[model samples]
Target: MLELEKVTAAYSGSKVLFGVDITANKGEITCLVGRNGVGKSTTMKAIMGLVSTPSGDIKLDGKSIFTLPTYSRAKAGIGYVPQGREIFPQLTVKENILLGMEANPGVKEIPQEIFETFPILKEFLERRGGDLSGGQQQQLAIARAVVSKPKVLILDEPTEGIQPSVIQEIGRVITRLKKDMAILMVEQYLEFVLEVSDRCYVMEKGRISMSGRTDELDKDRLQQLLSM
Candidate 1:
């Protein structure tokens, strides 16, 4: 399991998260949902070790990773796809996916199953990442993370700005991924969250204000919280 225990973080001396606690268990998708700018991305960044967690600890499988750097955290089994689908635009599709292998040294070959999961990737192996459409880039970003075979996969707003058809594909991918690893996703699409996630944590002002199994969430109450 991946866990944040009273995790607090800041940027340039400005605090963003205060005692934020969440957990992602293996074989499940744990989603964090809220209105924009409620420290959702910050929590993801802190889990990825991209930002400093000054006051609390992050642990993976009961081991503290608070002191590890981003790359080290990746090596320790955390795969993160940040907002904006940050793939290497100049690199070929194959090269960009292969780059993720560097997190786990000695991994010289891209897994064959990855191509099976996203067939479009195999078709565009030689194409520059920049040439792909927005949805394609998002797929590539997710592929890059999964190719590493991390214990926990963290995604931030994966459905944002994506086409409806591609969003369905992404949901399918997320469901498949949870069978092998824990998923910590930040999502805004309510139906997508309820459809794919096992648990949902609603965040407000850098804290989890409400959380429960997706099936248990009150429909009208959920809509009210989301609109706040």
Candidate 2:
């Protein structure tokens, strides 16, 4: 499980997140939804220690990770698939995934479940990451993250530019992964979020404005918030 309590973050002393609080429990998907520039991505970065959070705490399980470095956070069971996919362009698919094992030095081999979750990656193991399509690259990113068998998985805009079919596949993979780890994501695609998420947190202007069970939230209000 992951919990962000009264987390406030900033860039160059300009505050972004304002006392944000969220919880993602094991075996469930918790989504953060909001329009651009609402600090959604900043929240993820703050959790990962990629940005400075001068106040509040980010806890995995029950201990605070706010003071840990980025790599230390990864080692502590937080897997992050950043918004751009950010795969190493020159590395082969196999090599890229193998790099993920750095988070867990004791784990020498890529997990078998990774291939099962992404069969296409198996066939393209030797192919350069840059050569793969957008969807394949996104899949590769997720594969790289989950290969570490993290306790908490964080995805930023998983469906940003992928085709619809791949989006569905990613959704299914996300849903399945929840049974093994706490899943948290920042997404704007409401349809995909509604279909796969167990809970939703609607953020506005760097703060959580509303939150509730996905199905229990007022759909029209949710839609209206996203539109604005």
Candidate 3:
């Protein structure tokens, strides 16, 4: 339900993304895979309207949202768990999650199902967000996003610095999310991305160089492009 059409973005006058195009459909997972500094994250930032761009069209459910502010984008059903799982350090687990509700308009109550996807959060409802382990914080980040009940979810490297078991848990949660939300991610874990995503886009030098159905991807070609 999200489309990035020939997007080009930059800092000051220097551009990074050049005609970058990617799409994520409802109840599907679309992944962006690339080595470091290839503009994968930049693409997401553009979609989120975190950076002003010279040209592009970013649409959510067929509505033009490119010129909107980041807050407006979040209100329009985009939930983003950025790289590093930027949870509020001092806020109690319950309080941290409540912040997500700001994105909601008429919603009056928290979803009990938020705890269903993340039972760990229920037990530590009063704990400080910074006091939790990395995995717990990541889970909290995802749970916080879920509290908003977004139509599209964008996770930036959810597995970057966590234990294997938590990574597995995150994988399971994402699997379940794909049953409803349009999920998109920029991840370094190729196997994880392939296992969870329906389609993959490989970026190189700030552009999509290869992409296809995850199961049919050419491993060698992807490996070569990733090494560049």
Q: By TM-score, how accurate is candidate 1?
A: 0.97
Q: Tell me how many residue pairs clash in candidate 2.
A: 0
TM-score of every prediction relative to native: 0.97, 0.98, 0.97
Which sections of candidate 3 miss by over 4 Å? none
lDDT of 3 by residue, 175-210 (tens): 899777899999998778877889899998878988
Q: RMSD of candidate 3 to the true fold?
A: 1.1
What are the runs in model 2 whose C-alpha is more than 4 Å off? none
* Candidate with better TM-score, 2 vs 3: 2
Better candidate number, 1 or 2, judged by lDDT: 2
Q: List the residue pairs that clash in candidate 3.
A: none
For residue 140, give model 3's deviation from the true position in Å: 0.7
lDDT by residue (90-126, candidate 2, tens digit) is: 9999999999888988788888878888999999999
> What is each predicted model's overall lDDT from 0 to 1?
0.92, 0.95, 0.89
Ranking by TM-score: 2, 1, 3
Model 1 pairs in collision: none
- For lDDT, the strongest prediction is 2
Clashes of each: 0, 0, 0
